[model samples]
Target chain A: MPPKSTKSNQSTGVTSPSGYLLTCDPPMKQFIINLNDKKSADKKFILEDLDATHLLIKGDVRDEITRKVDEWMDENVFSTIERVGENLDTS
Target chain B: MHQNWEQKISSYFSCSQVQNVLVMPAPSKRKRAGDASSTASKVGRSSADSSASSAANTATQAASELTKIDPQEELLSTSKSLFEYLERLPPGTLRSIYNLPPPGGATVAAAVLRSSSLTDIARQCALRLVACGGKFKVGSIVEKWIQRHGQRDALLALRRLESMGILEPLGLANRPGQGNDDIDDEANDSEKRAKLMAKIACLTPEFKGAMKLHLSTMSSSPWPTIAREQIEEFKKSGGGAKSDGGEKESRDPPAPYELELYTQSSWDSVLHFLVGSDEAGKDKGGVEEPPEVMIQFLTRIGLMQEDPDYNGADRSRAPLVITSKGYEFMLRDTNAQVWQFVLQYLNSLAHHNMKDAIRMEALSFLICLGSCRVGEGYFNSVLQSKSARILMKDLARFGLLFVCRVAGKKAFYPTRVAVNLVASNEKEGSRQTDAIGQSVAATRSLEESLSAPVPSRSHLAVVVQTNFQVVAYTTSKLHISTLALFCDVESYRRLPNVIFFHITRDSIRSAFRLGVKADQILRFLHVHAHPMLRNGDHQLVPSNVTDQILLWDRERRRVVMDEVWAHQCRDSSEFAAVGQYASDLDALAWGNAHTNKLYVHFGKSEMVYAYIRKWRTKHYNS
Candidate 1:
């Protein structure tokens, strides 16, 4: 017999925790989780890890989370303008 | 009332010194009036005999009073009587009389009227009327004119003369019960009045004097003289015979079917460029690129725009991308699309400060083309004005005409496209055969054969599956490119006769950004669905795919961010109480007892706060 399926064991609740629900890709969720771990005591932004793509976070820290995500994106992403500049430099 | 006007007209003529001019034609005019009285009796008549006797007496008296008078004085008296007769008529009657159709059913007369300018055809008709002694029965002149030059141009000339007040209708009496009439009766009354007005007409003496002045100043024969001379000069230079290498071939014009093919191909090339098909940019497909001016015009009208990424030294050489307007234009039937281009051309003429005379010539020439028999070659030399010649060439570029040069003599044949340019969209499909005298079934088959290379008609060309797979059964580069507008290129698979692509979320989103609506894409697919799909008892382009496409479009606009206040509670009981209270106020956005938190909508945060304070006081007091 196959091992018991974990699908039935997963929680299926109608009610959700009240917070600012943030939905994003799995990588972005991981990034947010890492950011929450780095925060000092009593300054935790996330209230619950809802799923791989969702996070229930403190409403007061929403602006701070957005700023951090935008900063990370600016550093990680290669924009069209920057790519064009790099190509010009190589040429 | 009928006898009163007749007697007054005779008396007026008898007293005037110009009676000689009227007396010479009195007997003939009396006979004509006698003939008309038979038809006039149908409306209402007490006694035809009495009216005949009265008219006969006036004619005899006018004959007795006949005397040679000065031409100038004669013209003045004639003008006075003409104006007097016109003034005596009711304004409504006068308007209906003007609205009457000319004798030979000139359908193009309405367009000529809108242009509000006289054309060469109208001028020729005026000259013919003047030459025929300045007075003739409306039917005879129109019949004679139609017999010689065809019916299409005759009424345009006649209508223009009437509008200019040079030609006046004489016998249209106001109907008896016109005042208390319903719409249907009024329409019938107008038709009857129009029939009566078609009886007889005469030139006003003021116009005759002007014509005399015009004639005295003219150096050559007023009509066709310049055209004849130009042709003669051209022939003398061996332009007609030697250029085509054979005299016989030079004289024979291309058939209407051939002209249609030529026009269709040229027009397809223009559409191809608008769709940004590879064929339009390359010569491999033998697609003739539309003229540079036309391309510029497309950009100016916002149907196309220079690609922002194409940064070339020559801006004119930059690649063009179609705009939303262009896609909308492509969705319309060919007839409507052509008319739009023609109207835009007319507007551009005004914008460029073209002279009014040249503009009128171009306008009348376009209207004339609408009335021309398809495949019939009109001599280019007939267009004496340089501007008209240039307009003809431009129209040729637009695929409205097929211009062929035989020996240096250019003769432009109006294609079916040009002939139906002014036809309304509803009538275009049915009336196509009327232009070329072909059967409807034959024309449809011929059209399909000619249009094989381009999916111009609403023929079955697309097969869409419930899996979001789209297969277009066309090899035309234009059709393929258009399909790519909202189809995933990464999934594009090409076959000899079919091209397969998928409708992906990203592709549809990009199309939405380009301003194409989800419904338009669905409608496009449905309109071009495969015949097999249509015959089956199933929706074209499965409902699921259409729904998903629409859902994707809505998804882009679905996620709306709004500010809200999160309320934290100490316990589950407190959370339940606050949540219930906020719910009663219809301001609770979210609530969870486990976390003991409640979220209030931002707009109602103050209301919730006051409630929470009141609740706290009551609980603490308890």
Candidate 2:
């Protein structure tokens, strides 16, 4: 949902540089994480609109951790990043 | 006279040195027993006590005569000859006059452009002073910024000022601590204490670092009394002392930390002693762990900054800098912050200063730390390469970095405390919706990001939710708890998760406590409503309802602050150092967040003595 990275703006856009990234997924969701930011989306439904709040992570490494948080993942990523719905009982 | 004193012709090293110390990260010359500023102050006071008239005449006549026969041709480097310009002016307009750009223009770049090394920056500043007709005591523009900026950067700025011959030393006249046995043989205890305090108040950057090492090393024991005594002495003597004596005495006694006296525990004390360099708290020296990185993060983010009340900007386009406030909050999430600074520092180290084998090995170990992923697989990588293999073997041997050659990368896991530190901080950083939303109200923007402010708390939790799922991408359990406490935690999942819960009043209320964007909870719920509701046009959550719930969440949120040392010693070397006293080291990291004062624990027993003796014979003299 966010704009892709541009070559000119080193700080902006999607990036996959050489380094370690964390990826965890099972039968439910898939999330790939890099030190800079993340990407995620739901599998079952496609949305017409999702604000910047739902799309990108816009802070430095530390800022992202303390504030400015967002990560894109598979819509069905069963973990917390994908959970939603009415009657979603936590009993 | 000519036979007794040989004139050593000091030549500018087209960037060369005698023993070629690693030019990149070479350290500095500390405060000594008899520096020139101390001598000058002594002369001023003695003259005041005798006849001010005689003293003034003697100095005037001498100064007048020296102008005729000035030997040193030192060219002052600073763009401003403000001190000389204001020699006859009143004090009221002195500040404004000096701060103004010269009619000529700012020549800071031309004054400092040549030498590549920080050493040269220091020396060039010195040479500039010589260039300025041998009077290096020009009013410095760099002073306030150095004292009031991020520690590392402040030191760099300070070092430059010192080079240009402009810094004034704090009255750090050496004296014994309260319990040192040599009290009676020296000056009056109370008088010496006053001197020590005054000295500490105006301490040069290096001695100030010595003071920190002393405090940390003396953490245990009846420290409140000792610290209070020293701090009170400084205050009474008109010293602008930093935060002092609010900490509880460590249950275990403190190890004594003295630069020269307590020859024991010198090894451990030296690392921290370096904290005195203007770079102390802001992370310039080699740090012990990943949390050191968090300090760097706090600086990078808008948390660290000079209070707008303090620094006014100049029209210079150089590296963006963090202010004093940025450095303060940096110590708030102390452990994580320490790591953040250390990581960037290690990265910086990689670019330069890899000359010594030991340093090169240390550099590689740090790079390995940066290069590795956060999860179990990468953490458990095979120990390959002789340097890394040796390092990894030692890490596992000491329980720092674990390995699983068979799984290749899937065998190890940083403990809850370990993984949550700065090494994994950036990973969990993206997941910090709570921190982001909360810090928004508190954080300074852009340049201010490097300077910390009064560490904020009321707004730090904005998006964390129950069931161990953080709103942001972070995997920090502490953040998870920030969210989980109010709501029903569904299950413990290793990774981040998103919940599709019903938009109930209670759920919305709980979400509000996490932070402001929190107003979006109702909307968050609406978008993920039941299948039947999803088909309808009410995709946006109701505004008033969202606002109410967010307000409720704010009402419910509470912050629990951690002391500076609530972190583990995860480095192989430090762990090995700890292995000799594992239980004590672990206690230092966990027990009192402020009590990460390892030297104190070691001081009480054989630990401090042993380490000090070993270090003095090795590090101190070296």
Candidate 3:
């Protein structure tokens, strides 16, 4: 089943709720999940994995997480030129 | 005084002016003769001869009596006498009588007359009349002239010139009333019959003055002389006539269809590059690649974007990918696409700090080209400004003109695409473009290799099955690549005439990631459906397949994220009150009465807070 948005808050009986909005594609969501798993409980940035393409995370770490994603995309996503080169070599 | 009278009397008798007086009896016997002699004295004062005056008076008396006898005869005799009087006038006097002053001052009248540019037919008609001394009977003579010149629409040309004040009607033949009735009755007759009604026309004084100035300026100008010299130099250096006859043979200008093919091939290369077809770079022999400036322009307009994953290692080598906007642009008909490109080019000119006059000239030149005949060639020297000539070259690069050189004479033909540039009717414009496309395709198939495909034939049909299988009946590499964007390529197969592929979940999700919407895909398929499927009663693409595609697209978009302030209330009643206030403010994001929780959108959070404070204070104070 697809992961749905988490409705139940973790802090019971709290008067106010706060979190940061994180939007990314499903693959990026998986990356965030792996990052959460690698970190200690206190250092985990994610408050909730809301759905396939969204996350509820600690507001202070939002910029750091976004920078990491950018770095990852730069390293992992192949440019069109490289892809064309690869196709040429394979053909 | 007696000698002068005798001289005048002898002259009038010798000229036969006193025939009536000679025939009349003595003045005492004829009262009319006495009246004629009295009238003659008044006419003789300018000539200074009494007997001559008496003879002239007798002629007038005879004319009046003849008028009393017969009106037609009176008109005939009066006209004959008038003609004789005119013939006797000296040449200098006649010249002075006909040379009327222009209505307005010469310069102002000339400017006003030349301000409105004439249509081709009207210009030809004006030039013909001016050559014929600017006055002609406007019936069979003008009609025959128009026919001899091979101008079919003589009536339209005449009316146009008449409206422009270049020609004025002197008088109509036949009686004035009868002419008016004929005009009214023959208003709907064929042009030939209507043109038979004789009328006299002359060039207006303003037009004549303007033409004189124009001719004088044209002859005195140094520009045409310089241009002639330049053409001679070009001929000598460019191997026009003095070249070895073997390789430098002069050829006739390209026909309209050939120009269309050239234009389509150039344009197709640009589109293929945008689509990132594998064949784009390989097909350089027949098609010219779009210039670097155009590629940069595409990026600037957000149609294609530089790949974000490039790490700025080599800027020039950076790969540009078609953005979602570019994909959408590809779906538009040729005319709309060309217009968008042209408008964007104009906008880029403004951004590049081009002079206002040059930009306006370019726009007007485009409008003029739009009205030009498709196959006709216009001299390149007609573009007077240096910047306008450069613009002509640029437009040629854009497939809007076919620049040709024959015997050192450079001329440009506006292609079918260029001629239809300013077409206002959307349906007709697309139809014309499609016809050109079909013709180009038909010709290319004859000369191109069997494996090669013509990308200009954009409307080639595609067939889709209920089981997600797709069959596209086209050999175009551009079309295949575009389909590969959203189709499972693992199962893709290509043949000489058709390509086969399958739509899969992973491929669609990847397409969604690229910002392509399911509706755009569905629209593309519907528009390019196979003719067989289009004519059938069933849906173009199976209904279940379309539904599944929509469902797949909807799955990833379920999450809605908004910034909000969450509030946990003490009781359901408190939650209800706060929720109602937030809802009234249209800032309520979500609320659960059972849990006594409510969320207000971030923008209106302070207002909700103020309301809550006011409510608590009121309840506690009361």
B1-622 in candidate 1: lDDT tens per residue? Answer: 4344333332322222112222112123334334644322221111111224453344334333333333422332232112222223333333433333221012223333222244566666666777887887666665665567654345545654664555664433232223323422422575754563366667655455445444454332112222345555666776654644554345445665566557656667668778866565353544645533445456645788766677667554455677798987665444555666665454443322232343345545665576556645666777765556666766776678777654355677777767666433224334222232222322543446435775332222677876677878776777787788888886576656667777777788788877888877876776556555545687877888888888877655422233456777766767888898889888876666677877776677667766665675577557
Query: Which residue runs does candidate 2 get wrong by more than 4 Å?
Result: A1-91, B1-156, B159-368, B371-402, B406-484, B488-550, B553-622
DockQ of structure 3: 0.08
The deviation in Å at residue B352 for candidate 1 is 5.5
Compose the digit string of candidate 2's lDDT tens values, residues B139-197. 24123323354233423433333332233332211211233233332223656544432
User: Which candidate do you rate higher for lDDT, 1 or 2?
Assistant: 1
Candidate 3 residue B365 Cα shift, in angstroms, is: 3.9
lDDT of 3 by residue, B240-355 (tens): 65546554454457765577556666677678878876665453342333443455446645787766677766544456777888977775545456666665454433322232
Where does model 1 exceed 4 Å of error?
A1-91, B1-108, B111-257, B281-283, B310-333, B351-354, B372-386, B405-410, B425-460, B463-469, B504-506, B519-622
Give the Å error, residue B59, model 3.
Answer: 91
Per-prediction TM-score to the true structure, in the order listed: 0.42, 0.20, 0.44
DockQ for all models, in order? 0.03, 0.01, 0.08
Candidate 2 second chain TM? 0.19
lDDT: worst 10-residue window of model 2 chain B: B6-15
Residues forming the 10-long window of minimal summed lDDT in candidate 3 chain B: B41-50
- Positional deviation of residue A84's Cα in model 2 after best superposition, in angstroms: 12
